[model samples]
Target: MTMKKLGFAGVMIVALVGLSLATQAQVKKGKTRPLTTKQMMAGLVKPQCAGLGEALKAAPSDDKAWEELATKAALLNESGYSLMDDGRCPDGVWASACKNLQTASAAVLAKIEAKDYAGAQAEFKGVTASCGECHKAHKK
Candidate 1:
C-alpha cells in the first residue's frame, strides 16, 4: 500500500521507527537520557503550541499579549531545537521537519518583535504547517 493510503497510522509508525533508531544511535554514542522525545513533545511542544495557537487567534493588542505570544513562539522554537539534539534526529525527513519548525517559529517571533500583526499571522501559518508536517510523519 502507498503511504498516502496508510494515512496517519503509517506516518506514526514511521515516526516511531525513526525514534527507535535515534534512541539506539544515542545509546551507541554513550549519551545519558534526560527526557524521552515523547515526554518532550507532550510536556513542552504540546503546551507551547497550544499557547501559541490561542495567542495567534487575534493580533496582540498590547505589550502583554505580544509578550505572551513571543514567549510561546520562543518556546516552540526551543522545542524544535530540542527535537534535533542528542542524536534524536534519525533521518533526513525528521531533520527537515524539525528545521522547518525552528525556522517558522523564529519567523513568528520576529514578527511579534516587530509588532507586525499581519506578518505575524502569515508566519504563524508556517509554524502550524511545520507542526502538521512533522505530525504527518510522526504523530500517532
Candidate 2:
C-alpha cells in the first residue's frame, strides 16, 4: 500500500481505539450510578399503569377501555417479568406483583363484560390497591 494510504489507516485505527476506550469508560461510570427501584418503576412501568387508570375511570363501560387496560396490564407484567429474568429482583416478589396486577386488571375486564358496573368499579379499585401494595413493598 502507498505510504499515504497506510498513514490514513493508522489514524483511523487510533481514532477507533480511542472511541472504544471512551465508550467503555462511560459505561463503567453509568454502572456505578446503580438504578433505584423507584427510578425503574417510574420510568419503565408507571406511565402505562397511569394510563390504564385514566382509561378505566373515563370509560368504565366501554369495551375498548377494558381491552386497553388489559393490554397495559399485560405489558407491565411483562416488564416485571423481564426485571426478574435480569436478576434485578427476587423471582417470587416479581412474580407476585405481576400476577396480582394482572389478576385485578383481568377481573375489571371480566366485570365490564358482564355489564356489572359496580363490580367493575370495585375491581378497578382492587387493581389500584394491588399496584400500591406492590410499590410499597418493592418500589422506592
Candidate 3:
C-alpha cells in the first residue's frame, strides 16, 4: 500500500476505536444501579408527582408548561403501573397505597386534559395523600 493510503487507514482505524470507546463510556455512564422499592418511590416516582403538581399549579397561565406537566403525569402513571404489575410493592398496605395513587393520577390526568383545572387539582391532592398514607403504612 502507498504510505499516504496506509497513514489514512491508520487514522480511520484510530477514529473508529475512539468512537467505540466513547460509546461504551456513554453506556457505562448511563447505567444506573437498580433501585430498591423505596428508592424508586422516592427518587423517581415522588419527583414526577411533584413535577406534576408544580406543572399543574403553573399551567393555569402557561399552556406550554401545562402540556409538559400533563405529559410527565402520564409517564408517572405508566411507572406506577409497572410498579404495581411487577408486584414490587409486596406489602399489602403498600400495594393498596400504590393502587390509590394510580387511581388518583388517572383521574387527575383526565381532568387536566378536559381543562377541568379544579377537578385536576383536587385529584392531585388526593394523589399526594395516597402517597403519604402508603408511607405511613409500609415505610420503615
Best-matching candidate per TM-score = 1
List, residue by residue over 35-115, the lDDT tens digit for candidate 2: 544565677567876876676565455666656666775666565454444334443555676667667767766775675
**TM-score for each of the candidates:** 0.75, 0.50, 0.66
- Residue 122 of model 2, lDDT score: 79
Where does model 2 exceed 4 Å of error?
Answer: 1-40, 60-67, 91-95, 112-117
Superior by TM-score: candidate 1 or candidate 2: 1
Clashes of 3: 0
Error of 2 at 18 (Å): 32
Q: Give the higher-TM-score candidate: 1 or 3.
A: 1
Instruction: Say which candidate scores most in lDDT.
Output: 1
Residue 35, model 3: Cα distance from true site in angstroms? 3.1
Q: lDDT score of model 1?
A: 0.81
Q: Which stretches of candidate 1 lie over 4 Å from their true place?
A: 1-31
Which 10 successive residues of model 1 have the least lDDT summed? 23-32
Instruction: Kindly state the number of residue pairs that clash in model 1.
Output: 0
Residue 25 shift from truth in candidate 3, angstroms:
31
Clashes of 2: 0
